[model samples]
Target chain A: MNANSKTENRALASTVLELDVNNHAGVMSHVVGMFSRRAYNVEGIVCMPVGYEKNGLKSSGETSSEISRIWLLVNEDARLEQMIKQIEKLEDVLSLRRHGAEHEVFERLEEFFH
Target chain B: MAANSISNQKEMFMTSKRSEILTGAQIVVRLLERQGVRLLSGIPGGAILPIYDALSQSTQIHHVLARHEQGAGFIAQGIARASGEVAVCMASSGPGATNLLTAIADAKLDSIPLVAITGQVPKSMIGTDAFQEVDTYGLTIPITKHNFLVGSAEELLEVIPHAFRLAASGRPGPVLVDIPKDVQNQSIEVSDWPAPGASDPAPAPDAVLISRAAAMINGAARPILYLGGGVVHSGASGSAVALAEKAGLPSVMTLMALGAMPVDHPLSLGMLGMHGARCTNLALDECDLLIAVGARFDDRATGKVAAFCSQAKIIHIDIDPSELDKIKTAHVGIAGDVKAVLGQLVPQVEAILRKPWLARVADLKATHPLRMPGIDDPRMPYGLIRAVADCLDDEATISTDVGQHQMWVAQAYPLRRPRQWLTSGGLGTMGFGLPAAIGAALAEPQRTVVCFTGDGSILMNVQEFATAAEEVANVKVVLMNNASLGLVFQQQTMFYGERIFASKFRGMPDFIKVAEGFGWQTLDLDNAGDPSSALRAALSLPGPVLIHASIDRHEQVLPMVAPGAANKDMIGG
Candidate 1:
């Protein structure tokens, strides 16, 4: 396919989600469970604890190792809006930002999987 | 010099209020006391013995030992549903935690506030499959509002109070806190105490959206108020009724929202759903504006979502934002407390008589009202509920197990106040009634609590009868002995080409003997010439009494919208 067609195909096939969540042992289970329970498939996931800055300063004290960022790639469907709303309802999910399929986060990691 | 002296004195005072060493179990009990939990229910086991030991030392809190872990969970649900406060229940590891899952899930679906504390295997043996070990936190992740797996005793100080807060705050649900055996035994020094967790104030309704909703209501010639469980949960029934009356909107309630608007109200259409009155559902079919408050469009409530109120423009108000468009998109969706939204929206809307529309509704009501067959005969299902209801005033709390009896009570019983009626609406749990009724009675000792249960439902939680007898709870269990799962039988007979399977029971236990064996006062209405008087006498002298009455096995909950069918396609009434 041509470059523009390839991008269009990808957009039609999937959407990427960026999530900021609490870094805890059960956090990943909770995020995945929400999908698994609904029978919604999550094709790719990349999660890692990131440097969480609070008020533009490095968070200290007990919350030093608090936040983690998660990237999810999944098929776009009618239920996606409802799924996003549900994910936002989770207590551990700090924030969620939706991105189109053209987002580079998942595309860049495709080479490693290949 | 004076400021320096004052600072020195403050430091001295801080040092004097030093941390005292206490085990995690002691901290849990102390925290529950601080949270103003006077009564809790649980069953002690190997893992939870330490907490029970600590509980025994607590003079402020009283623990009711339930016959089963599920009973304990439902008991807590009962207290929460009755009092609108976050109630607590505890259990040990493995099976105990698993058993409590259903009640927790029930609370979650109904949005009742509950804190469930379960004892976990020691942290070291957690993954080793030690005796009575379970992954409680993982298991409860989907069912609970939030859950905590405490790694350390110090975490208990924060987790306990936080669990209560999470359970009570926005769209309340059950929160589980799993404490490992080691954590419960571990000693920790705790000086500072956290404040008791209470419900956080709901966010304010959007003025623009509220105004839009007001405009829609004002402009529509035909409008209907759709009330849900959220109305009862948020204590917004009064405000909802006010909005309905002021706008002259005929109101229909979901099963959970039955008591929100008085059944006797002139503008009330009673309940609208699967087994709702024909007129109520027909009115929704005809409305131009559907104002849904605090209610998600549950499938049972909204039969065939696409077809439900197809002509109406919906203005949905709920505390949970996700629920707004989850099923059906709303014209104006307001994610705020229903009580608060109505408080503001009521005044902004124009007060109109809508005479022609109301007259149309009245004609529908006159033509297709709820048919209570054998309503005056005490031997029949509807009559039994009415007879039971006649014996007690509005102060009496009515609960029901999931079955034909539950629907009969929902259809016929005069539930005139909010929280006056409690049934397993969302979960449709059969075993919920007995234990929940005991809990409600225990919570509010003055009010007489009655549980209308069918034979099939009462058998699911028959063990709780012993707990009720032991506690001497003012619970009246009116057993409708139909010798079968009535609702299941009805569905099979109607939808499955008249083929009935395992719905009927071949052998039935002598329930009166069973109740008497459990130390309960037994009343057999089967032979009573004056059943009403017998019911009154039994209800008056209540300390866990079982009043058994035989119902026809073939009786069905009518006006049922066949599964996945539109509400307009109701079968019978």
Candidate 2:
């Protein structure tokens, strides 16, 4: 591994952020760009369309679902509060929930990466 | 029977009008008209031709054709800053879109309300390096409050209104809407017209936090009101001034909040931070409580963040929650509309005369006031600004391009009203003054607009002179010629061992001749027997005019706070 990976490995205390966002072509960029621009590294990201249901009613569209859920694994740092505040400011981010490092979402996929 | 049938037909017509087929371009124009956009600025090019063609038929909206895309963007910014309204700018793909990025970024940093609409290449042609093609949506994402890429004509209805809403909402900033050429050309039937987008009501101030903040204000011995651009953005200048007066608190304005409190007010400490008056910085240094209202602790406003207001407990109030503790952690952070918060918090606080503190501030003012070396000489920088101020009243708007001239005006000019001063504070854009002045003039035709520009800064967007002349905008371009980038030269003189590299221009353009060439009336103060009279005469002219004055390049903006230095430590004024 490179020096960067070593640095990441040293920062063992991590947090998983679950974000519900509007499904669109540019939503991913808005979500990921926030981390990249601030130089905050994302350890892993998994995203998939949840459904077209909004306000408990299915959106009538043949093209695709209206919303998606994004999971982000990032190192816990002092700037995380500020980072979350900035992300929450984006127009598409519906809600954000923080999970502890023990969350199994990233752990279950770790074997596949190896 | 005929009257009854006519009434029934009218009812049928009203119902049919609710749903109609419109091209994306038409929808965009109609939505803007509904949003009360009477005027917009842009330049037409290949990618945006469809929108332009549709806009040409608009009876309700008038488009000002700018010489450059950046000029158009700044023009929009000028309108927004001057009126505290969400303004719009349009540009084509690629270079046109790229050119607008600077102004958009400037708007973002300053929290100015602007909607930038750009044309993109057809959806299918995107990422193929087609002619005049660029990823405008991608480029603007980092700069804007929010951005949209419209996939269909149907999306235009939702996107356009949302863009306005986002631009004008709490903690206002620029928003971008990139419409593909095909999308603009596409036809779609719209059923229900969305209501014109407006700012959502600000979250109510936390009553507990408000009470705490008020208690802190009432209890503090030496409290200072720190105002920023957000004050102007929130339309809370009156409330801010009232708060200062009622509590007998000394107030200091950031560069973007120059006219929040009249500089001549007894409690007004002109500006705080780098290049601020010695008295202002000294007062801030000694302040026991820093009541920051709608003011982010910008590095310029608070030199060396760790050292800034070190003695003070901060009570920070802003509409944006993210800004509350982002810089200096506030002891009492209140996130709400400043106007509303002040409205409630004002009555709760016990009004007392802070006599000793005011006396101390007054003593500081008397001993360490802002020094203007040649304030009476019209040829000098400070004097030139003063002379111009002498000629115009508070009704005349003042804008300046970035450099030494900007600092001088900010320091010396006696601005008394909100929305009376416009400058590129956050981005420090060089070419902002002229076009912004034009936009201000266009927005409020009755007001005389004056733009103070330096030799180095004017050349950046000099092409806007033609637009000013064509529109017959009542603008006087006060060109302060120093033949060098004065700020850079000053920095090099101070820190870089006086080794000036590209800061000095080898050959200077005769700005008087250039202005004349651009169909502007020119007045050379260098040639005039009485520079003051010449300025008055030039300013009195109805159409676009240029008044030029020459200054020594060595003159510097002063009482300088060296970068990263504490505010208390300063150089000569």
Candidate 3:
């Protein structure tokens, strides 16, 4: 169980960069296609809509004045910083940030119906 | 003047020969009708407007405009599951097709036969990223069992029948047909009709492997039967029960295999999982050998893979070859239809007299009996369910949405026939109960059909209540109204230290008023009286009925094998 702890953390690995597209028109769809076809660097991403009010900003090239946010989780490295730069250029995109490690891999469950 | 007149004649001739002509609306009906599609459920969109216009004029087939495309997909699933026949659904190319994804995925997981036909933008502009021209073929491949793109009018008839067969055959799932606009507008000769029965996938049972499985089961001292959804899909429910009855081995169903055995039967252990009965888990733990039929060891079924029945010699049988030894190792691996294999295994088990094994399994059941906690009161929720089951015959079909009510039905009802229970198994899609039960009722109107759903699940497609009322379908909806998302809140209470985040819905409208609003006679099961009178009254009251039973908020389904715990370690009060 402690094999990884005993071993060194010398191997270079990537982290996920999340984008919150707020169900905005074809932003996330185009983004996913771009990643799959063009970037091919981001791995294991999940995106859904959040509120633009929380971020206190507006998206670019959106036909509607009402702004929306999208949450994306990506797996990368310094590449995350670079991907952020590219995603910012897309219209109808407000702000993108990495949701840091705060999740728990469910260990002990007391419930019967899961 | 003579030259000009000749030139005009030549131009007229060339214009007549320009490509081929097919009316957009006529193309839609011809492709579907020629393939022998008798039933289709969907709301028509602009992209598919022409198709609907054509279908309206044709009285040969029936087209039902579903309240939502999602409901359309589920209804198609119900028809396919009951009849084992392929059902069709039509939707517009873009937003319409996207809405149908959940249902398609549901059909894929449960192995239901469905052919979802979506209209696409014209083929003239192949990939300019044109309007309503989403790559539906590519999007549905991973989710659907199979998919097709019809590029020409000639292949229209060819694709339709092939789609029907491909979806109906072995390990059935949804197939998507993306018909381009240009093809729909072309006229073509149809002298040769493509026969509709060419796509059946029959994975024949291996006779040698069946005998080998028989030998293993015949020799084991203590054997237990584990069943899953494939048993239901493969029509192997009879063989499953026969194997259990012959060997005197206790049978446990996965969530998907609820109807394989009558719940009240002595040999039947209701379900085996986190919410499984204590007796069922104990049976799994104590058995000397485990005979898994048409069941892949899902994580929910096997909480901790390493600790799951480690002492037992496992024998696995499945139609899919890769499933063998994928999750857990098997002592004997047999790939074939479970029914065929079990037909051979029954006689072989008769030869082996494993009295000790039977005694041990019975002992295990005796030691860990799962008695419902609120058994003393007649008004108890479980008692209410038992009353409902008693009123309906064993042959009646039951469909359920995922929740506490779903588990309650599984723990209580006794089933007699095969393909009588349809549900969302692998992907527990909510709002599956009412529409699915409607389809089941339509498939066999004479038999009593009942659907059990929670307030949360029912709200997902509450409009279908009107559909049930509108259509001459007799479906009884038993709404377990705790006025909460019972399953979600139950898990949060047990696991999240009772934080109670986003699962509360207390002060709602009078459920009776709501049901009556939908034109359903509502019955409030307030106390421990016989609900049979209300049920009888509703059965005669024209169409569908809703029985709303109020249950406790904190009630928990027990015998939990915690996430990553062994089957033997299941905890129940």
Instruction: Considering the two chains of model 2, state its CAPRI-style docking category.
Output: medium
Interface-residue RMSD per candidate? 3.6, 2.6, 16.1
TM-scores (chain A) of the candidates: 0.79, 0.82, 0.50
Summing lDDT over every window of 10 consecutive residues in candidate 3 chain B, give the lowest-scoring window: B190-199
lDDT of 2: 0.92
Candidate 3 lDDT by residue in tens digits, B105-201: 9987777889998887777764778776677766775577656666677666656776777776656678888877776666764444445544455
Question: What's model 2's TM-score?
Answer: 0.97
Model 3 has an lDDT value of 0.72
Model 3: CA > 4 A from native: A1-114, B1-36, B125-133, B198-203, B375-378, B527-532
TM-score of chain B of 3: 0.90
lDDT of 1: 0.92
Query: Lowest summed-lDDT stretch of 10 residues in model 2 chain B?
Result: B149-158
Q: What is the Cα-based TM-score of model 3?
A: 0.78
- Which parts of model 1 are misplaced by more than 4 Å? A1-12, A54-64, B1-16
If ranked by lDDT, best first, what sequence of candidates would result?
2, 1, 3
Model 3 CA RMSD to the hidden true structure, in angstroms: 13.1
- In terms of DockQ, which candidate is strongest? 2
